[model samples]
Target: MKMTPHENTKQFPALAPGPPRMFAPQTSTAVSRPKKNSTACLACKAAKRKCSGPDAPCKACRSTNTECHFDPSRDLRRKVAVKRTIQELTNHKDLLESLLSTLGSADQLQFDKVMDLIRKKAPFQDIAHAVGSPATTFGDPQELSNASKLAILEYGENHIETSGNGVRRPSDPGNIASSPEEIPNMKPPQWPTVSPYARVTLESLCDIPLFEVPAKPWTKVTDDDYLVSHLVSLYFTWDHPCTQFLDQRIFLQHMKLGDRRSEFCTPLLVNSLLSMASTYSDSPDVFSTPENVFSRGQNFFHEAQKLWEVEDDDHDLPNIQALLLMCCVFKCQGRVKKSWMMLSQAVRLAQDIGLFDTPAVSKKKMLPEMERVRTITAWGVFNMSSQMSIELQKIAPLEYPTSDVKLCGNEDFDWTPYPRSNKITYDKKPARLPEVREGLAELTRTLVDVQNLVSEKRRGTNLDELWRKAQDPFDRLTAWLQRWPSVPEIQPNPVPQVLLLRIKCLQAIIHLFEILNDPHQPQSVRQARFYQVKSVEETAQCLRIHRQSYGLKHIPSQIVDAIQTGLRILVPQLEESDESRQAFAELCRFGTALSHRFMQTADVIHEIRKNALHLGVRLPPEVIAIFDDPEQWRSLEP
Candidate 1:
C-alpha cells in the first residue's frame, strides 16, 4: 500500500501480467493410460501380475522375493505357431485336390488296380505310385504315417468285392473303359428313377435302415450273410414276377441298409422268401439232406413258422407278406389244406390293417412306395384267394378290394438284371406289366362269380335261377376275352401272363358251358353235344400251348394250377378217342420233365391219375406207363 507503482512493478516484474491476457478453462476428461511394452518375469507371468521391466527382478517378483526369468525364444502371443498350422493345412488341402484330380481322370481298370492295392494294405508310397503320382511328391516318411495308411486301407477294404478265396482281384479289363480319351464320350449310367406318381421313392430310400447281418433279428434266420443275400436275390428273380406283393426296391434297400427296425423287411419275411426260392436254387444247403428233395427249404420254412407264431404285429404289412409267402410254401410242398388255412389268416390280417380302405382314411401314414405296395398286396390277396377257391371248388374268403388305388406300371418297380451265379452275362428279366394284372384281375373276378354259381348249383339251387345268374358272368368273361386276345403260340415270349390269362379264360368258358348244358336242367341256348366238343377242343389247345412253351421252368407257379385245371377236364375225355389219349400222354411226359424241379406239378400228375381211377376211365398203356414211372412223380432229390 505504501510503495509506488514503479517500485511495485520492479519487485514483481516476473509476475506482471500483459495487458488483457485471456486464459481458457481446463476440463477433466477420463483418459486411459497406454499399456506397458516391457515383458513380465517368469514369476510375474505365472502369477498373472504386473512387472516394472526386464532389467532385473521385476517389481512383482522383487516384492514377492521370487527370482526373475525370461526366455527370448518364447512367443507368448502364439502368432508364429498359428501361421505354421495354417500353412500345413493349406498344403494338405492342395495334396488332396491333386490326388482327387488324378483319380478322377484315371480309367476304370487303373482305378480298380489302385483300389485293389489299397485294399491289400499296401504302403503309402506303393499306393501313390499306383495312383500315378511322382515318387518324390509323397516320399517323405513324415507325410503319411503307417497308421494313417492302415486306416485308409481299412476303409477301402470294407467296400471292395472280395472273392470266395478272400482276395480282391482287379476288375476285368474287358468290363472296364478302354482309354482315358473316351471319358468325354462316356454316358452316365442309366439307373431307374421313381415314377411321377411315386415321387416319395427317393425319400424312402434315404430313410432306409443300415444293414447289419450280425444284428439280432438277422441272426435268427442264419449267421451267414451271403446265404441270406443269395436266397433273397433268387426270390426276386424267380418268384417275384409270380406275385409281386412286396416292392423289390424298397425291400432290397432296407436289406442293404441293414436296419432291422425297418418296417419293409423282417426275419419272418426273409426266411419265408428263402423257403419259396429254395425250390429254384441248386445249393445243397437249401435241402434238409441231400437225399430229400421234398425237404427242400424246410429249414427256412421252420424258422419262418417260428417267427410267424411269435410275431406280435398282426396288422403290419411285412407280417401279412410273410403269411402269404408261407401259404405259397405250403402249396409248393403239396400241403393244400395248410395252404388254404394260411391264406385265410393272411386275408384276415390284411383286412385288420384296413388295406382295403382308401389311403385318406388309413390310420397309419405311409410312403408313396408303401402305398403302392399295399394296393398291390390287396389285389394279390384277392386274386390268389379267388384262384385257390376256383381250383379247390370252394368259396373265396376275401372280397374284392374297394380302395381306389391306381394300378402300378413297370416303371414303378426296379427291373435291374439279376445275376444268377458268377456268370458274366445276367439273366434277362421278363416284362411283368400292370396291364397283364389288370386283365387277369378282370378275368379272375368273373371266374369267382362263376365259381359261386357252381357252388349254388351243387347245393340244389333252381336250374333256371342258376342259369340266369350265370348269364351275366358268362357275358363278362366273353367281353374280357375280346379285350385280351389269346397268344397264338407259346414261344419264348416275355409276357407269359398274357398267355396264362388266356388259358384261364378258356378254362372258365368251358366250365360255363358245363353248367348251361346240364342234363338235368337243359336249355335251348346251345346244343348239349356241342358243349362237350367245344370243351375238348379248348382243352386240347391249352395242352398244346403248355407242351410247346419254352422255359416252362421259369413260368409263374399259377400257370401250373391253370394246367392242372385243364388236365382235370381233359382226363375224363380220354376214353372218347385214341388221339385224345395220345395228346394227354405227351403233355404228361412234358409235365414230368419239370416235376423234378417243381414239386407241385408232380402232385398235379398224381391227382390226375387218382381222379381218372375215381371216374373209372381206362388209360392207354403208354399213359399208364408215364404215370407208373416212379422217377416221373418222385419228389425226392436226385
Candidate 2:
C-alpha cells in the first residue's frame, strides 16, 4: 500500500511542470497602453503617498515641492516574512525564559520540540545568539514596571526608585507616607482631658451594648434601635454629655458613610451640641474655663439651628423636641427674650403639625412637661414686668401724687368735712381710675384663664392662645402702671393696684375655703381646694414682701418695721403666747426661715459694696459703742 502511494505521486509528476505551455499568451497583439506620467507617480501602499525612488527627489514630489525619498527598506515581498521570522524567534525566547524561571531541567525539556521548530526557522545569526545568551535577559522592561506597580499597591510605599540620573535607590524610610505612622516618631494623641462634671465619654453615656448586633432580635434584652432611641432621650436630659459627642472628631469618623445610624441619631446629636453650648454660656465658673469650648458650642448651636429648620417630615417631632430643649437651656441661662422667641416657634410648629393632638396609642407618650413649661414661661413674663414696674416707681415718683392739692369749690364751701381714706373705691368708678381698674381686672382674668388651662389634664392646645392671653394682660398692666395717676391719696396707697390685687386674692381664698367646707363637695375636690388655699396664701405672702421691699405704704411702714423687730424679739422668746408663736411660725412658713443665712450672704455682699456706696458710716465705732454700753447690749438681746 505504501508503494502504491509513492507510485501515484510519480505518475502525477507531469501535472507539476508544464506551466510554459500557454493557453492564450502566444499571440502578440499591438495593445495601445496609456503612457505613465512621471509627474504623477502612483502612491506607495504602506505610506499612502507618492515617493521618489533612489533619486533625491522625484518629478511629482518636486512639482508639489514636498521632501521625497524612497523607503528602500519597504520591500513589500520579503518584509512580512522577515518580520514574522524575527517575531517567532523572539516569542520562543521569551517562552523559554518563562519556563526556565518557573521550572527545572525536566520541565524545560518538555519545550524541546517547540525550541527545535524555532531553531529550524531562525537564521544562523539568531540561532547562535539564542544558544549563547540565556532567555532571562529577554525579560521585558514593561513587565518589570508592571510588577513594581503591583508590589507598591500591596506593600504600600515600600519600593525602589530608578532615576534618569543613573541612580538606583530604595525609597526613603522617613518618606513612607501610606500608613497613619507616616509622620515619623509621632505618638498617637491622648484623649482630651476634661473636668469630672464636664467630661462625657460615648461608652459612659451610651448603652452601646444594644448596638452590638446587626439585627434586632424580638426576644433580646435590648435591641439596637431601642438603645439608640434611649441614648437620644438621655442626651436630651438636663446637662447630659451626649451632646459633646456631636462635635467630636473621633465620633464623626466612626459614623460611617452610607450608614442609616447617623440619621436616627441626628436629633440627639444636634440637641446635645445645643446643650453643651448653653451650659458654657450659663456656667458661673468663667475663670477656670477655656474660651474655645464656649465658642465651639455657640457655633454648634447655630449649625443645629439651621439643620432643625430644614428637618424632614418624619423627623419633625424629634426635631421640635430638640429645639424645645435648646429653649430651656436659653431660659436657664437668663436669655429670656431669646428663649421666649424659640419657645414660640416650637409651639407654633407643634400646633401646625398637630403633634400636640397625636394619639396616645402611638409610640411616644405625650409629654405634659411641654404645657408646664409654657405656663411657667407666662408667669415668668408677668413677674419680670411687675418687678420692672416696681423698680420704675421707686426711681421716678409719679408727679401727680406729689403736686399741690386744689379744691373744686369756692372758699365759702368747706369741702374738708369728709376725711379721705386713701383707698380707691372699686364700687364707685372715676374717669381715669376706671381704665386702671379695668386693666387690673383684665390681668386678673387672664391669670385665671392661664391657671385653669394649666391645671387641665395636660393636653396640648394652641399654645398661641395662652401666649396671646398672657400678652394682652401684660401689655395692659404695664401701660396702666406706667401712666398711673399720682394723687395725694394715691401716695398713701403707693401701689393701689397691688393692694386691690391682695384684697381680691384674699376674697378668692375665702371662697375656696367655703367650697372646701361644703359637705356636698367630693373629698378629692376638698383636698384639691386645700392645696389651692396653701398656694394662694403663699402667693399673698410673697406679694406682701414684694410691696414692703418696694417702700410701699399700703400696709403701714410702722407695722412692717414692728413686725421685723418683733420677729427678732420672738427668736429667743420661742415659748411666748400662741399668737406670738404663730407669727414666728408664719415667718418660717414663708421664705424667712433662711433669713439668717441670707443675711450672712447679704453682709458679705455689702462689705464689698461699702466703699462704692455714696453714703459713709462709722460701722466699727457704732459696733464698739453698742458693745461698750451694757444697757444697749441688753436691749439688743433676742
Candidate 3:
C-alpha cells in the first residue's frame, strides 16, 4: 500500500494506454435491497422488517430462516361479523315494534303480561297467546297482515253468540230481539205480485215454529232454523254444484257445530246463502209481506246487507264469499246493475288480497286451510266473473291463474247429504262437483277466446287477419274435443251432471264454428257444417241422458239456456230436416217446462214462439199443451 502510488501509477498508465482512457463508468459502492411488500407475513411484521412479497418465503423471513404465514381476510372478518350482529338486533327490534303496535288496544293487564313475557325472553307463541291472538305465530310481518289481532277481536265482539247446534243466542238475552215499530219502516215491493199459493204453502204446512232461529233483529222475520236448514239443503243440492265456491265439508261442519269464530262460517255468509236458497223454497217467510213473490228472501237479504254494513275493517274469505252470494241474490231479485257492481267489487278485493297471485304466497308459507280457501276462491272468482262478462257481452276482467295451486285434496270427499233432505241418494250420485267446475272453467276460457275473436271481427279486422288470429283458438277447440272422453250411448242409471258440462262444450264448439263460417267472411262451410251436425248429435245425446236420469224440473237452468240457444241457431234447418223439426219440438217442450221457473226463460220462450210464427213453423202440440195446462206446471214444481 505504501508503494501503491508509484507502482500502481505505472500499471494503470500501461492499462489506460491500451484502451484509450475510459474509467469504466465509475461503479457505485452501494447495493440495492429487495423491494418492500405491503402485505407482509406475521413474522416479518412482528420483527418490523420489510418483505419482498407474499411468496413462499419473504426477503426478511428467508434471511432469518423463520416460518411465514398470512391471514388474507383477517381485517374484513371482524367488520362483517359486526354488521351481521347489527342486522339480527335490528330484526328483533322490528318484531318488538310490530307486536307492540298490533297490541296497542289490548287491556293493560294483558299488555303488561305480554311486555313481561317479552322482557323475560319467552317464546313468541306464549307472547302471542298472552295478547289474545291464539292463532298468531310470529314469523314475517306479512303474516300479521293476513289476520290481524284487531280483526279477531272485532269479529268476536260484534257477532251474536251461538249456544249450540240448535239455535243462535243473542249477546244480551234480556233485550227484546224484535221491534213492532220497524215493520212500518219497511219499503214496499218493487216487482210484480206473487200468487196467493206462494205464501199459503209454508203457512199451511207448518203453523208452529219448528226450531228457534238466531235472536237478531234481521232474522226475526223468519225465526225457524228447521226451515232455514231445509233451504240450505236445497241450495247445496242444486246451486252449490254449479258454483262450487265454498268448501262444503268444512262449511257444513262449522255450521253444524255453530262455531261463529270459525273462518269458514259467518252470519253474513249463512244469511246470504239463505237468501239465494229462497228461490227454490215454497216457504211463506221467504216472501217479504206474504204477498210479493218477487220479494222472496227480502228479509234474509236485508239481514245480509246489515251484517255486511257492520263489517267495516275486515275483508277475509267470508266477506268475499258473502259478496259473491249477494251478487247472485241481486241477480235473482232482478237487480242486474247491482249484481255487476258487486262482482266488480269482489274481483278488485280478491286482487288486493293477493289471492290472484298464488306464486307470491309460496315464499311466505300459508296455512293449509287458508291456502285451500284462496285457491278455490280464486277459481270461483274467475268462473263467476267470466260468466257475468259473457252474459253482459263484455271482455273478461280477470285472466286465468297461471300458478300451480291445486284443487282440494281427495280426502275432502263428497259432502254428506243434508240430514233431513232425501234429495241426494247413492244411486243418483252426480259427477264429482269439482270435476264439473274444472271442466266449466276450461270451457269458459275457450269461450273467452271465441268472444275476443268475435269482438275483433266486430271492429272490422280484415278477413285474412281475422282468419290468422282464429287459428289458435280453432286448433285449441279441436284439441279439446279430441281430449274429451266419449259418452256411452246409454248413460248409467242416472245421468251424471257432467253431461251438462259436455253439452256446454259442444255449444261452445258450435259457437266458434259459427264465427268461422260467418256469412260476411270466406267460409269454411264443410268444417262448420260438420261441427254443427256434431253439436246437434251431442245435444240429442244430452237430452236422452236427461230424460233417462231425471225429470225436466231437475235439469239445470243452464241446460235450458243451452237448449234455447241451440234451437235458435238451428231455426233455419227446421223446415227442411225432420231431425231438426224433432229437435225443435223437444227443445220447445224443455223450454216451456222450465219457463215456469225462470222469468228470463218465459221471455225467451215468448220470443222463440214469435220467431217460429214468423218462420211459419207451428209449435208442437205437446209444447202448446204444457203452456195451456196449469196442473202440468204445478206438478213439475219442486
Candidate 4:
C-alpha cells in the first residue's frame, strides 16, 4: 500500500512517532508582516543600511569617506507620524477616563505606568507593537492627558450659551462631559441657616470665585450673607449702587455700627456726607432741613479728629486733610456766630501746625485743601456782610433807606440847615451816634488790617500765596462797595460813581503808598507797582466810562443796580465802534504774542518767591487791557 502523507512522515526516522503535520509552501502572505525600520538612521536613506547620525562621525560615512549629512526631511516625517499617533491616542477621552478609573481603583496609579498603558492601548498597530517590541513608539500619557483637558476646557468656554439654549454640542466628542449643560446643576449643599462659621466659609468661597457662585434654588449661601454685607459696605463707602437709601445722619450711624474704621470712614464717606449736608442746606426739598445733617456732620468731624489724633504714621495724610476740609464745609453752612467759632478753631489748628506760616508741607498734598478752606472763609464773610448791610438799611432809614433820597433837583434834595435848637454844638464835643457806626467801622478796620497783613506776607511767600493775596483785595473792595453808600459822604460834592471811585482809589492809593514807601524794595518791585498803578487807572476809567454811558440824573442807592442798567446797554454799542473793536483786536494779538514772555516771568517768580525776582516781570499792556475788558478776553481763542 502507498504511504499516507502523515504515515509516511511518521514512518521516516526524522518524523519520529508524532503525527505528520501538512506544511504549506511559504508565500508572501505566509511570512510575518515586515516591521517598519525605525532603527535605520535618517542619514543613510540611499544606503539602505543602519547609520550613526546622532553620534559624531557616522561609522558608515567614515568608512566610505563621504560627508554624512542628516536627512532632516526624513526625520521630520518620522516625527510627524509619531506625533499623529500620540495625538490620536490623547484625543480618546473615554479610553483615558476608563484607564484613570481603573488605576484609581487599583491604588497603583503612577504617571509612567499610565503612560505605558496608554501606549499599549493606542489606536496605531505600530504604536502598540512598538511599545511591546521596543523601537518605534512615541509619547507620554501625562502630556496627552493635559492636552486633552486643555482642549475640553477651551471647547466648553467657546460654546457657553448667551441665549436661553444653555450650550452647543462640543465639536470634539472627547469634550462631551465638560459641556456646561451636561454638568449637573446641583446647589452647593446647604448648611444650617444660623451658622456664622458656615456663612464666613461660604462668603470666602464666594469672594474668591465670584463668577462661579450660582444663582438658583436656595443654596447654603443666601445673597444676603454673600452680597449684602460686603456690598452694603462698598456702596456706602464708594459711589455706587445708584440709590439714595440713607441721609447723612443715618448713613454715618450705619457706618459707625459696621465697625468700618478704615480711611474710607472720614474723607471718603464722612466728607461726602458733609458735602451732601451743604447741598441740602441750600435746597428746600431734599433732607427738608439741614439742621439734623449739620449736627451729625459736626459729630462726624469730631470723631474724625479723634481718629486722626492717634492715626498710624503710614496712613494717608491727605485723608486727614480732607477731614479738615469737610469741617470747613460744614462750618460755612452754619450761622455767623457758629461759623466764626469754627473758623477760629480751624485757623488756630492750621497755624499751630505751621500750615500757613511755612510753605505747605507738601504742596501737591495740601494746596487743594487750603483752597477749600479759603473758599469757605470768603463765602462766610460775604454772607455775613450782606446780612449786616440789610439789617443796617432796615434800622437807620435816614442813612440807609431802601428808597433813594432823590439827590436830583427835586424837593427831596433839600439843602436846609438843621435848626440851632436841634443841632448839637460841635465846639465842646461831637455827639456819638450809636454802636452801629462803631461796629461797622471796627469791622471795616479789621478787614483793612487783615488785607494789609496778607499783602505784606504775600511779598515773601510762594506763587500760590501771592495769588491768594491778590484775591483778598478784590474781596475786601467788593465788601466795601456794598457798605460805602451807608457812610455819610466826607466830600461836599459827591458824584455817585465818583464816591464809589474814591473808595477804590483810596484802596489803590494805600497799596501804592505802601509799595513806594519801602526804600529797600528792588527795581522789579518798582516795575510791578507801575503795572498795579496802570490797573488802578484802568479800573477808574471803567467806572468813569460806566457813569458817562448810563447818563444817570441822580445818585442811585444800589451801585450794582446803577452799573447793570448803565453798563450792559452800552456794551453792544461799545463793541460795535470800529475804533474800539480795532483796539480790542490789537490787544488780543498783543496778548497772544506776549504769553510766552509772561510765562517765563511767572516761572522765574515761582522759583525765587521772596527775593529780587519775587515780583513777576511787569504784565504786558495788552494783558492788562484784557483784564479790564473781559469781553475782549473772551473773544480771543487760547
Candidate 5:
C-alpha cells in the first residue's frame, strides 16, 4: 500500500503516506552528540545548559549573580549545616549567659585572670618556641607593674637553665701570683717626705715578706669549719658587692660536701671568699680574737695570691673572680694600690676571654645561664675598674656600653624582681645585686671623666674648660638619680647591698663637686657648698642604713676615708666665721673619731692632711685638732 511519488500520494492515506517535506523536516543530518560540559557545576547540570562563564560566575546564572558552578543539592545540605552551626552558636551564647548567672563573682574574676594569663602567655610561648627559650611561669602579682614591653623579654630569661662549659679552672698552687709593679695613668705621689703610716701600709701589701704574711696553703688552713661557714655567710651577706656572681648556693652546696667538682670552683676561689668573709666579719666570735682571725684571713689571701700568679690558669673565670674578691679585701684593709694592680690584671684577663662580645653574637653561641653569668661577672669587673679609676684619679680602662659588646636582655627595663633561684641563671630579672653594683659603677664612670678632666695639669686644662666638659657627665648623673630606686627593696629575699651603692653614688657626686676648685663667684660657690653638704648628708644617710642592716665594724677603710675626705673639703668652704669654725670643728672631730675606729684609715687621713698643709693651704683650727691632739682624737668613739 505504499504510495507512488506524486500521483498516488492522494490515493495513499492522504498526504501522510509520502515522505515528509525535505525542507520542513530538514535533511536528516547526523545527530550531533553534545560533548561533556567543561565546567562541571550542579547549576549548569540542573539548567541543562553549557556554562560558558568562568569558574564562579557562569553565563547561565549571570543575571542572578548566582554561583553557576555550585551544586544546588549540595548547596541545600550546606545551608542546613550553616543553619545548624548558627543554632549551635546561639545555644552556646545562651549557655555562656547561664554560666555567668550561675558563677560567683570571685569565680568570674578568677576566670578573667586565667584569660589574662593565657593571653599574656600565648605570644611569649610562640616567641619562646622560635628562640628555643625557657618561659617563666606568669603568676606573680608584683610582676604586673613592669611595663608590657619588658614582660616579653623577662619571662624567657627567668626560666632559663644555664649549663657550664664543664671546664675546671683552678690556679696552680706552685705558681706565684704577679703583683702590679706600676699602675697605668697613675701619677706617683709628690710629697715633701713620706708619712710613717703610708710607707708602712704600702709595704704591708707590696712587701709581703717584710710583714711576715707567711704562705699558707688553702688545704693547710685552720680546721675550724664553723668559723669558715660563719665567715662565708658574712661575705655573701655583707662584702660580696660587685662579686655576687660566683653562686653562693652552688658554692655552699659544694662546701657542704667534700667531693667538690673541679669545674665548680677552685681552692683559690674558696680561700679568697673565706678570707674576704673573715676580713669583713664584725662578729665577736671572729673579731674578738682579732690576731688569729685577721692573720688567718691574710694568710688565706696570700695563698690566693700564690695561686693568682699561676700563668697557666690566667684564663680561669673562677681565678679572675677570686682576684676580684681579693681586691675588696685589699680595699677593706687600705691596700688600694694592691687592689688597683690586681684589678688591672682582671680587666685585661676579661677582655682576653671575649666577654666584650656584642649581644647579637654572644646570644647565638651561648646558653642562657653562661651569657648572664659572664655579663654579671663582667659588670663586677667593670665596676671595680671604675671604682679604682676614681680612687686613683684616672680614667677607666674599659669603656661603657659604647663598645660593640652591648648589654642585652630586659630591654623593656623590667625592674620587677623574679624569684631568686639561689644559684645564678643568666636571664634572671631584677638581679638586684648586679644592678646595685652596676649603679655605682655607672656613676663612677661619669665621675672618672670629670676627675680626669680636673686632674689634668700637663695641658693646663683650665677650670672653664673643665666646667664646659663636665656638663654632660653632670646631666648623666642627674638622669641616673631620677631613674634609680630610692627605696631599694625591689627584691625581697637576701637583701641587696643598696646602701653601698648609695654610698658610692654619693661619693662620686662629692668628687664631681671637688673638681670645681673653689669657684670665685659667690652664687657658684654657694651652690657648690650646698652640693657638698648635700653629698655629705647623702653619705651619712647611706652609712646610717648600712650600719642598721650590717654593723659598722666591718666597714671598709675606703668608706671611712671617703667620709673624711668629704668632711675635709666641706670644712674649709663654710662661712669664714664662728658658725663656720664650729661646723669645721665638728666635722674634724667626727672624721678623727671615724679614723680612730678604723686605725688604718687614720694613716690615710694623716697623709691627706699633710699633703694639704704641704701645698700651703691655710689650715683651720679644726684641721689642727686631729694633728695636734692625736690622743684626743684616739680616745673618741665613732
Candidate 6:
C-alpha cells in the first residue's frame, strides 16, 4: 500500500526512524517490610548516637569522619553460636567431673594433664567472657589451674574452696561459701530435647483449673479409675499427717468420673503424686522395687521441676502442693539440695498467699470449708522450712515476728474450744488437739530460734546467752512431752508422733553441745557429757518405737543426723566401758538402715570404721557387708 520505499521517502524526505521503546517489569509490594531500628555502629553507639547502617561511610560515621563498624553482639549468628558454646562447655564440665570418680588416680592425673593442655591452648577466654565469668578471672593460665578452673565450672563459685597453692577443697559448711542460698540459685541447664514449656501454655495455666475437663476422649494417662482412687487415697493418708494440704472430701469430689478435669492435669503433679504414693502405697507388685518405680520417667523430678512456674503460682494451691510433693520425692531420693531448694520455693509461695499470717489474721479471710486444710498446709511449710534451715545451718525463712497461721484440730473444720472452767495445764488431763497442735507450733518456732543461735559460726555474741537460749527450748519441749499424750491424735497412734518430736528435740540438744559447746568454757565438758547421754537414750527409744509399731516409713535426714551425732559423742567414751560399746553398736545399726537411701551417712559410718577401729567398737555383720560395697544397699530394701 505504501509507495516504493524510495518514492515514500521522497514524499517525506525529512522524516527519519525514531528510537525504539522497551518493556520494563513492575515493582513488587510483597517484598515490602516495616522499618526497623538499625544496629548502631560501634563508634556511634560509644558516642550515644544512632547509625543508619553498617555500611562504608554510613550516615553517622560520615558525619563524624569515623569508620563504620558493627558491634560483636550485633551479629545474630555469632550470638547464638556463642550461647551454644557456653552451654556445651558447662555440660562438658559436669560430665567430666562425674566420669572422674570412675577413673583411677593414674587416669585422673592423665586427665588433669590433658585438661591443662586444653585450657592453655583452647579458646576458654572468649567462652568465659561469653558465659559472664570475667576473662580476667579465668584468662591467665597462672591465675587458675585446670583443676581449679574445673571446680569453678562444675559447682559454680559457691561449691568449692581454694587453697593457697591453687589446690581445691570441698566446700565446708563453716565457710560462708556453702550458704543455703547457693543451691536455690543454681539452675539445671535447659536442652533442646527437654523443653518444659512443651505442650503446656503459660497464658492461662496458673488461672485455669488444675484439672480441666477434656473436651475430647482422654488417652494420655490411663482411664483406670481404680488405680487413681487407690493412689489418691495413699497420698492423702501418708502425706496428710504432715501437710494436710488437700481436703480429702473436696479432692475426691473433684476427681469424680463426671466432674473430672483432664486438661488441667499437669505431668509433674501426676508424676510426683504417683512417685510419692508409690513409696508408701500398699500395692506390692507395682512398687516391689522403689528404685525402678522412682526412676520411671528417667529424671522425671528434674523434668517436673522444669515445669514449675514459680512466678505464676503465687495463688495456685494445687501447683504449690505439687511443688511441696516434689520436695518430698527429692528428700525420699536423698537429693537434699534439691529438696531444700524446692521447700524454699514452697515457703515463698505460701508467703505470697499470706498463709504465713497468724491464726487471728488468716481466719478473717479464709472460707470456713477451706479454713482447717489451708491453715494446716501453711503451718506445715513453716514447720518444714524452720527445721530444714536448722539442720542445714542456713538463715531461715523470713516471717513476721509473731505467729499468724493457725494450727489444725481433729474436727477438720475449726479449732475445737475447751470449757472455760477447765484449767488446760500440761500436768492435768490430756489436752484436746487444738491445745496439742498449738504446742507443736510453739515447739517448731522455739527450735528455729535455738538453731539460729547455735549455728552462729562467726558472730561474736556472748556464750552465756547462746547456752541459755538453747536450754530454753529443751526445757519447754520436755514440759510439752510430759503432757502431750492427753491429745486424741497422740493417744491413738502416739508412738510415731511422739518419737518424731523426741528425735527433733534430741537433735537440738546434740547440736547445742556438739557444735556450739565452748571447749574452754567452765563445766563445758561435764555439760556436754550429760547432753550426749540424753541424746543416746532418746535415739534408742525413738528407734525402739519405729521397730515396735510403725516399723519404718522412709528414714528421714533428721534421724540420720541424730544417729551420726550419737556416734560422734560416743567415740571418746568407747574406751571407758562395755556399756559405751553397746551404745556404739546400736548407732552403727541405725546408720546402716538410714544409709539405705542416703549414701553420705554410709560414708560417715565407713570413715568411722576405717580410721577409728582402735576405738574397739565393732560394726555389725550386715553393716560390714554394706561397707564392703556401698552398692549393696539395694540388698537392704526389706
RMSD (CA, Å), each prediction = 32.5, 42.6, 34.6, 34.4, 32.9, 27.6
lDDT score for candidate 6 against the true structure:
0.52
The lowest-lDDT stretch of 10 consecutive residues in candidate 2 is 409-418
Instruction: Report, for every candidate in turn, its global Cα lDDT versus the true structure.
Output: 0.61, 0.35, 0.62, 0.34, 0.52, 0.52
User: Candidate 3, residues 1-638: lDDT per residue as tens digits?
Assistant: 37754574453335443656756776655657976455667787788777676775877778889998874433222334334333433434434544654457434654575678879997664443343221222334443333234334544454343466734444764342254465566453243433343544333444332223342322444666677766777677657776767877677766766766767777888888888877666566676534223345778888888998897535378888889999987765435778888888888777767777532443467788776777777777887787666556666547665333355444324433222222334343543666666666677777777788778877988766866887887788667766665567337543335667677677777766666675644456666766776686667667766654454544454575477677676666665676766776667666666554444455466567668789887666765676455346445421
Sorted on lDDT, best first, the list reads 3, 1, 6, 5, 2, 4
Instruction: Provide the TM-score for each candidate, comma-separated.
Output: 0.57, 0.23, 0.60, 0.19, 0.51, 0.52
Q: In candidate 5, which residue pairs get closer than 3 Å at backbone N, Cα or C atoms, i.e. clash?
A: 176-309, 177-309
Per-residue error for 79 in candidate 5, Å, reads 99
- In Å, residue 241's CA in model 2 sits off its true spot by 15
In model 3, the runs with Cα more than 4 Å from the true position are 1-221, 289-295, 332-335, 358-363, 402-405, 412-431, 485-490, 493-496, 514-537, 633-638
List runs of model 4 lying over 4 Å from the truth: 1-323, 326-332, 344-450, 453-638
Which pairs, if any, clash in model 3?
none
Which number leads on TM-score? 3
TM-score of 3: 0.60
Q: Which stretches of candidate 5 lie over 4 Å from their true place?
A: 1-219, 242-245, 257-261, 282-296, 357-364, 401-438, 441-445, 448-460, 485-496, 518-530, 548-551, 556-558, 573-599, 605-638
The stretch of ten residues in a row with the least summed lDDT in candidate 5 is 207-216
Candidate 2: residue 152 lDDT (0-100): 44
Candidate 2, residues 569-637, lDDT tens digits: the string is 334333434443444444332212111112221122223223323334222333334323313321221
